[model samples]
Target chain A: MIQKWKNHAEAYLFVTPSVILTVTLGIYPILWALRYMFYDYKGYGEAKFAGLYNIKRLFRDDYLWDAIWNTFVFASGKMILTLPVALLLAVLLNGKLRGRNLLRGIYFMPTIFSTAVMAVVFYLIFNSYNGLLNQILNMIGLPAVEWLNMQNAMLTCIIIAAWGGIGNYMLLFLAGLQGIPKDVYESAELDGATGARRFWSITIPMLGPVLNIIMMLAIMSALESYEAIMVLTGGGPSGATEVMHLYLYKLLFPVSTGETMAQDIGYGSAVAMLLALIVGVITGLYLYLSRKLNDIYS
Target chain B: MTRISGRILTWTFLLITAALLLLPIALAMLGSFKTNQELNAGSALLPKVWQLENYLYTWKEAKFSVYVWNSVIYSVGATITTVTVCSLAAYAVARRSFPGRKLLLGVYSAMMFIHMGVLTLKPAYQIMVTLGLHKSVLGLIIMMTGAGGTTFFILYAFIRSISKELDEAAMIDGASSFYIFSRIILPLCAPALGVVGLFAFRGAWNNYILPLVFTMSQPELQPITVGLANIRYGFGGAVQSHLMLTGACISMLPMLLMYILANKSFVQMNVGAIKG
Candidate 1:
């Protein structure tokens, strides 16, 4: 009985520190943010009860709607480009070819750099007059394009994101590929299933679990993306690239908006709750899909 | 003949894609070593003369050394806190047959989906003010330790992979669970810890938003990422590409060097993460 009590104490002791930090830092802030949704308060002002006013204001905010639409465009654009390229790269690296490790290392290089730093490097490379892309274009006797203009701002951001992100996802897919038993491929080969047919039949089905995991992660990240957009365009070329999170950040901080520097903590929280609802839906889908995949796997 | 042709096609495609992906980095590295005159001449692929002075200028003008040290402190502090705290909790749930193990595991699993993103910023900022942790790098590290969302699950899965018999045998020897955890489990889980450390350090080092938001008024306390971003847009307004690229290169140098040294392990760690 003494030993049982000791075991319980020991276990609780081991887990308590982490639970405290997680609750204080991660969980509590979220609850606090939710609490702010019902009050109309700025940073230093008194919290006046303005029930549902923030929510009503959120519905009428065109900028918020625009930011949401732009975020969707950015996230979808990133997903559409990132997944196939990462899968293709993973497949290429999975082959028993010479210098595969070297190629893999090179491919994964971009994933390691700071996104802000990479954004700057990309900014230089895509510069309108002195950029590498335009220089190449001029050399090839072609017209130079305004890559960071309002129309192309989001596209440029997507391209930059894909360049840096493909490596991490490719590694995930490669791990999944390596887990597949070789005998499956050999038996398929015995039946004369070669190339695309073999890949479509065996590899794709085998990678389904990892694919779902990556898809969930990719969507979550693409939605939460701020650093690259902040560094590259600051959600600009005339707010063409303002994402939901960036807009929320602007609302919370309110740095450069001279008179608008009055921090609207409540309204910002309302906007954030709406975005969180979207993320929550996606998270539910991901959870449901993961359980289904686990069921299939088992 | 078809086999040979297919192999060639695959190689060609891989090489082209690799080149395309790496070209921007290559341009930055090359441009960093060139003169402004050379950059203006459009000789971007290779430097006519390696201007090492650009690095020196950036290091001094941008206060790279201070930012580098700040980043090292924050990243290392955060990584240690995460690995120690999360591994301890992971071990409890993974090994010990305790009362709340199931509940703790459920909580962590649910927390995985609630990323919270920028929603935590307002409340976190307010909390930091109340606790007097704002405007300092250590405060940011404290915030990071709290945000170990996926890291906890990854470490838990890793701890679960270790054999149960070891813990049982250690218990039979009258060894305390803490002794077994500290002496037996942690050392055995060194490889996972390395993976966690790499991730923790890299995430903190590359983190831009938290540092930017926290260190908004305190420029001197900023890390290299914030420093480089500020120089590019704020301080180094209308600056030459060579100098701007130099700052970017300096920010990337540490991770690049780490990758070069442990290329194999980095790849394995990334792959190991997903295999969980």
Candidate 2:
């Protein structure tokens, strides 16, 4: 009994720090955030018994709805562009071309830089007057356009996200490609399966699991994208690029504009909870379907 | 002749794609050395005169030194804590058949999904306040170390992949569990540790939201991400784009240098997911 107790103690001792910190920082805050969903408070202010008021406010809040719409558009836009481009790059770099490793390294460079830094740089590049893109346009005798205008802001954010992100996904896809046995491709080629045919028939089937993971990652990252939009546009040109996380930040920290945006923790928590639920449902559904697909594969 | 042309075509396509991908970063590097006036009077990609003084101006004007040190501290502190704590926990879970071992692994894997997003801000702040970690760089590092995400799962897999007979051999010689862990398991897991260290470093270094929230009142404590955002918002329309680009390049330098030095290991990170 004592030995069993000691084993248990040792196990607990080994795992205690991680478990405590994860619970404190991860699980506890989530539960706490959920708790804040019910009460009315302004971040540090006193809580009042205002059940579901925040949710009701959220339901009627058009700006919240607009932010939600913009987020989906942004996430979908990023995934749509990023995955295919990454796959193409991965395929190109996966070959026995000269300087393949050098090309791959260059492609993967953007993944290392801070998003805020890149976004700031891109903001300058996309600046209305003296930006690089505009300079190029003018040199070619085209008029300078506002890239961060209401119609174009989300697209600009999407492009920047894709530019910084494709490298990482491409690396993942390259690894996935390399994992396939040479014999599989050789056999396919011997049977006259070449180029697009080989890619579809052999490569795609083999990369099933990796593709699922990449897709899931793309979805999750896109959904939670805040930094790119926040740094580049500040959800500006009339809130065109405001993603859900930025909306949540604006709720709590209300970026000062002389006329203060309300700092309501309760409302922010409710919106955050709703956003979390949407992400959760989408993730859960994806996982469920992917598991079913895995069963079929097995 | 057809085959030769095909090779040239493929090479040209790859070259163009690489150039397009690298153009923004190259522009930032080049533009950082230009005068603000040259940047303004510009259709030129190349600066008329290389203003190496732009670096010094950005360093002083933007307080780049303070933010760089803060970033280094956060990345190093968080990386060490995360790697140490996570490797210890991962070893315990992956090796030992203890009570609640499965339960522990399940919790870690479950967190791999179910991202609560920024909703944790209020309570995270509260916890920081209670622990007097708010507005402190150390607090931000602690919060970062608490993220038992990809690193934990990857380390768990890495530990599991090692042979069990090694542990048995150590036991036969009367080595303690801690001794075996320190001497045998850790050294074996160095490659995995390197990958985790890189990831932890990048995550802490690039993290904008947590540091932004934690170091709101303490400007000096903020990392480069928050610092750059401050420069963007504070100056609004009046801020010189060239100066900001110089700051951006400054922020990119360490990561770029690390990647260049350890290019092989950086590419090897992708395999971690495939193994998992």
Candidate 3:
């Protein structure tokens, strides 16, 4: 009995630090944010109960709505660009290609760098007047494009996002590809499925579950991404590229000179709650759809 | 002839993709060595004179040394704490049947998917301030260590895969749980711990917003990510594009080296994660 108690004590002690940190840092902040959703409080000063004013404001806020629309566009654009490319790259690389490891390393290189720093490098490359791309265009006697202007800023952001993300999704797809047994492919080949037909019929089905999960991850990450955008454009040229999180960030921590509003923690918390809801609903919907997909496969 | 053509096509396609992917990084590296004038001119792919002093300027004049030290402390501190806390928690959940075990597991799994992103940044900083830790690197490390649920789950799966016979045998020899855990299990868990440590270090090292928000008041506490952004956005007049690229290269080197050294483990870790 004493030993049993001691064992329990030992287990509890082991989990204690994690529990404390999670509650203080993870769970507590969430609750605080949730609570602050209904209150009017900045980073400083006394809190005042604003009831549903923040929520009402959120419903009517044009900037927040624009940000939401932009986020959807950005996320969808990134998804469309990244997923197919990643899948194709994974398919190409998963074979017994020579120097495939080196190829994989090169492809996955972008995933490891700081997005902020890379976005700056990209800024230098994509700068309109004297940027690398424009300079090359001028040299080639082609018209120089304004890559970071209002018209092209979102596309530029999406392109940068796709570049950073393709490697990660490719890795996920590679893992899935590796799991499909060699004999399965051989059997398919014996049955006369060849090339693209073999891939469509066998490989796609085999990768369904991983593909679903990767899609969900990719979408969630795309929606949540702001660091690259923040660095590249600071949500740019007229808030044309402002996504949901970047909007919230600007609300919470407004830059001094940009076209940001005064810090509005109350409204920002409301935005945070709304953003969380948006993410949650989309994730839940994706999970449900993926479940339906798995059922069909099974 | 068809097979030869197909193989050639595949190689051509792959080489093209690889070059396109590498172009930005290659440009950054080469551009970092060029004079500001040449870089702005943007005509030359190769630097006429390799301005090696760009690195020196970034390190000293841009105050990257301070940022690098802070990042080292933050990453190392977070990695150690995350590894320790997660390993202990994982061991408990994996080996022992305890009160709230199901609840703990449920919360952790939920937390893994519930990425609040920067939603919690404000309140997290507030909590740090309340604890009088907001201004310090230790505070940032502590807050960073909070989101280790994924690490815990990974380690839990790993520890569960480890045999229980070792624990039973250790118990039969009158070994305490802590002793078995420390002396026996920990050494065995070295690989999982190493993977987790690498991930924890990377996450902390590359983390932007949390450190950005928390260290806003204290410039000295800013990590490399924040420092790099500052040089881009907050630098008074002329954007030091060359110095910024140099800093970007400097910031990337450690992670690049780590990835090179542990290439297999880095690849395998993601594979294992997705499989789980």
Candidate 4:
């Protein structure tokens, strides 16, 4: 018993720092947040219980639906657009390309740039006036409009998100593509499943497992599109691109013209709790679906 | 046969996509060589006039030296600590047959969500205040470690791929857990560590949100990411292609070098991640 206890202490000590920080930050704060969610507390002071009022308020919120729809549309748009683009690029680059190595490094650049820096660059490039895109459009005779404003905020955000994300998924897809045994492709080709036929029959079907993970990752990131919004639009031009996570952030911070910062602390926590549950549930569903698909593939 | 045309089409498509991928970078690099006036009106493919002094101008006028130095300190400090701590924790989780292994792994998965998503702002502020970590580089470093648990999980997955025969042999020879970890396991795990370190370094260097919220108004403590963000606030109606391009190039240098050095392992490690 003593020897077993000694081993336990050693393991405990080894993982203690990470565990302590994780639990304090990871587990306890979450628990604290959950408890705080039921209260009518602002951020600076004590929290008071308000029953399910905060959650009840959540169901009637207009922006919640807007945020949810934006999140889904943004996430689905990227999954649909970026994944195939990444897959096609992965297949193209997986072949005997001369500059594959150089191209890989080039692709990784946007991914490596801090989100702040990426927002900075794209903000400049996609600016409504005198930015690169509009400037080019002027040369080709197209009138310019505010990209981050009411017209196409979510679309612009999705494009930016896809640009930042494609490199990551491209790399992941590249890894998945290369792992498909050359023998499988060779056999399929011998059976006259070359090129397009091979991709549909052999490449994609074989890449299914990896694709599942990649799709799930892309979707999860799409659901949590706060950083892009925070850095790029700040959900601006009259809340045109207000995603749920960003909305929750604004609730916590309270940046509206009239509302004080501390006024919505309790309200924000309730919203955050719901947001976490939604993100958690979506992620769980992806894992369950992917596992089922994985079993079928195997 | 369409083989010749297939090869041509492949090269053409990749080259076009590659050009699109490389646009901002190439423009940024070329802009670094142009005068302010020339940059605003210059072609995208090439600068109308070469004015390398823009590099010197921003380097001095913008105080990029301090920003770059601070970036180095935060990124390096965070990477060394995260890689060391995460690797040790991961080693224990992998090798030690503890009762809470499953629970610990679940915590690791949950860590990914809390570290960066909706909980990022509040929990970080709360922890920093409680731990007296507000506004200090080391505090930022600590939060960064927690932020990097996904990285730890990735490394753990890699470590699981190697056989346990070496550690088993070491244990038989009276090597202590720390000894076996430092000498045998850590050394063998260098390649994985490199991948982890690159990610940690890039993440630290590029992290905007944590540093944005955590650091007080001390400009001296600001990293390159924040410095670039400053450019946005002062982004008067004109295009500062020369300045933006120079900044992007400077910011990309360290990550670019690491990406080149570890490209192969990066790919291999990712393959391991998906397959597992």
Candidate 5:
């Protein structure tokens, strides 16, 4: 009994640091956000009990709704462009291709660079006036395009997002691809399965579990992304590229870009809760659907 | 003939995609060497005269010298803290089934999916402020260490995989748990620790939001990400695209080198991730 007590004590001692950090940084902040959701407060000054006032405003706020819509569009656009390309690259590179390691390294390079820094580089390249892309187009006698204009900003953001993401997902897909045993493909070949047929029948089904997890990661990441957009567009050209997180950021820490936004901590917290709910529901839904698909396959 | 054509076709597609993927980075590198005028007006891929001055100007004039140092401190500091805290907790969770272990694991898993995005940034900032550490890099380092949960899970999985006989053998010789952890388990956990360290370093280095918020009042404490953004958005009136590109290259080189050096570890880390 003494020895067991000592073991428990050691365990408690080991976990104490993590528990303190988690509670302080993770759990406490969450509760703080939850509590602040019902109060009217800025970064400074007194807190007033707003009750459901912020929630009511959240429903009516056009900008919040627009941001929510834009977030979905941006996330979906990035997903649509990223996953297939990543998977294709994974498939292409999975074989004993020449310099495949080098190729994979180059592909995954962008995932390591700072997103904000790359976005700045991208900003220069995609600049409407005298940008690298436009300069090339002009030299070839094409009309200059307003790549970051209100209409095209989201699309440009999506392309940049996709470019940054494809490599990481490709790596994920490659890992999954590797897990599908070589014999499965060999047997499929023995049964007269052609390349396309083998890929469709064997590779796709074999990758289902990995695919599900990858999709979840892709969705969460795409939705959470704002740093690139923040640097690239600042969610703008008339708030055209404003995302949910960016919206919250602007509210909480309004960048002094000649536009004075009243810092609404209460509204921002409410928006946060709603955003968390949306993410939870979507993740839950995806998990449920994936489980169903897994059942069917099994 | 079909096989030859197929090989050619595959090479063509791969090369084209690779080139497209690499174009922006290539442009940024070349643009870093070009004068502002040349970059704006000239269509040449190579600069008229390769301007080594752009880098010097960025380093000194744009205050990247300070930013780079801060970034190193932040990344290294956060990495060390995260690894230490998470590994300790991971050891406990993996080896000993103490009370509240289930609750602890459940909370962490739930936290992983919460994805509050930057919604919690304000509260986090407030917490730092309350502690009066908001202005210091140490505060940001502490706050950044909250990425512990993921690291904990990773280390937990890795530690669990380590053979139990080593611990049992050590224990039979009257080795204390701490002694076993430090001497035996830690030496064995080097690979996982390396992976976790790299990840923590990368996350901390690339982190923009927390650093941006915390260092809002303290510009000198800003990391390269925030500093680079400031050069683009906050610096003076005119856009210094050349300097920005140079700064970008400077910021990218360290991570690029690390990636090259530890390329195998990176792939191994990803594989470990999926398995976990």
Candidate 6:
């Protein structure tokens, strides 16, 4: 009993800091955010204990759903477009191609551009009057676009997200593609397994584990994205491209008439918690369905 | 017949994609060379003129001289402390079969499931407010130290891959655990340490959100990331494409230097991802 107790004590000491951090910074903030969900707690001042008020307000909130809808469309669009492109690119570059290092450097270029910077760049490209994007369109005799304005806002943001992101996925796929033993291709060639058939049968199976992890990573990243949306649109021309964090930001720092920031702290915290839960569920489901959980354990 | 065609198609597809990726960065680089009017009038695949002034102006413009020093100090300070503390903790867990070790590992891992910033910035601010670190870079360093431990913990998992016999040999050589750790274990742990240090560096360097929320008054103390964002806002969006391009150039400078110097190690580190 004494030995076991001593062991437990030592274990407790080792783990204490992490436990405390997770509680104070991780778990406690979540519950705190949850509690504030019901009240109208704004950033600066006193919040009323309006039970279920914020949650109810969320249902009646049109902008909340609009943000939700935009975020969904963006996330879905990223998955479909980014993955196959990354996979194909990885497969091509996995071999000895000309300018391989230069290509790798170039392909990974946009990712190195900070999202805030990319937002400015994309904003420039999509600008109407003197923007490069409009300049090209007009040259081709197509109508010039008002990119960040209402109509093209979400679509443009999605394209930017996809562009900046695809490289990281490609790298991950490259790692997976490299992991497959060359022997399989050698043996498959002997069996008259031509290129397409070999890829379908051998490469896919060999690559399953890595591809699964990449998908999980892609999903997690998609859900967690805030910077791109924040920089690109600021929840937009009448909240057209508003996302969860952007919406929370707006709620906390409302720019409307007679808006007192301090008064809405509770509501902001509530939105924060709801957003946390929504992301948590999405990630949890992805973790479960994909090979992430099984493969993660050491 | 299809096999040859497919191979040809693959190269074409990748080349086209690579070209698309090249477009923005190439534009940003050349944009720095052009005068503001030229960039606005008509920017294309190439710059009409080369203006090294954008780089010079950006350096002075953001006072990035100070920003770079500040960023280096904070990130390095956090890196040194975080690696030491986390490696100590990780050593204890990976080497010893003490009580609650599994439980302790589970608790830390479970914390990973929570959103990265959910409770972190808020309560951290509350604590910082009390510590009077609210607007200080030291406060940012400490917060980063705490967050920085998680990535190192992932590196810790990689440490488990090495055999225990290595530790046993050191112990038999009359080395104290401390001596053995610093002398033997730590040296042998270089690859893991390298991965952790690089990760910590990239994360700390790229970080903007923490500074944005935590400190508002100290523009002098701002890092490159936040400083670049401020430049964009200061310029006012519409007609300031050159200034915006200058901001992009400034932000990418340190990262580009780091990437070029460490590209091999960087690639190796990604392949080393255990928890990321």
Number of the top candidate by DockQ? 5
Candidate DockQ scores, in order: 0.67, 0.70, 0.69, 0.47, 0.77, 0.45
The best candidate by lDDT is 5
Q: What digit string (tens of lDDT, one per residue) describes model 1 on residues A1-298?
A: 9989888899999998899887877788778878988999887759998999999998899989999999999999998998898999898788777998888898899999998889888887777776778888888889989999988889999999899888888888898898889899899989999779988989988877777777888898899887788777878877899998888878887773222435788888888878988888976787797888779966
Question: Model 3, range B1-276, lDDT digits (tens) per residue?
Answer: 998999898888788878888899998899888888888877568999999999998899889999999999999999999999999999998999987999998888777676666767777777777889888778889988844566887888899999999999999999988899999999999998888888888889998888888887789999999898888875768877788789888888899999999987777666666765
Q: What is the lDDT of residue A57 in candidate 3?
A: 95
Query: What is the i-RMS of every prediction?
Result: 1.8, 1.6, 1.4, 2.8, 1.3, 3.2
Which one wins on TM-score?
5
Alpha carbon lDDT of residue B168, candidate 5? 91
**Local error of candidate 3 at B234, Å?**
4.6
- Model 4, span B1-276: residue lDDT tens: 599998888778777866776766565566667666664553554666677777786778877888898889988998888887788788888888788988988868766655235455576677777778777888877777743366678768767877899989988998888898899888888888877777678778888766765553677788888777667656566556568767766787777777677777656554555554
Fnat computed for model 2: 0.69
Model 3 segments more than 4 A misplaced: A255-259, A296-298
Q: Which scores greater on lDDT, model 2 or model 6?
A: 2
Task: Report the CAPRI category for model 6.
Answer: acceptable
Looking at model 5, residue B146 earns an lDDT score of 52
Ranking according to DockQ, highest score first: 5, 2, 3, 1, 4, 6
lDDT of 5 by residue, B179-222 (tens): 99999989999999999889899989999888888887788999
Model 5 clash pairs are none
Off by over 4 Å in 4: A140-146, A254-263, A287-298, B1-5, B35-45, B113-118, B235-245
**Candidate 5 local Cα displacement, residue A134, angstroms:** 0.8
Specify the CAPRI tier of model 4.
acceptable
The TM-score of candidate 1 is: 0.94
Off by over 4 Å in 2: A255-260, A289-298, B1-9
Tell me the spans in candidate 1 whose CA falls farther than 4 Å from its real position.
A256-262, A286-298
lDDT to native, each model = 0.83, 0.84, 0.86, 0.74, 0.88, 0.71
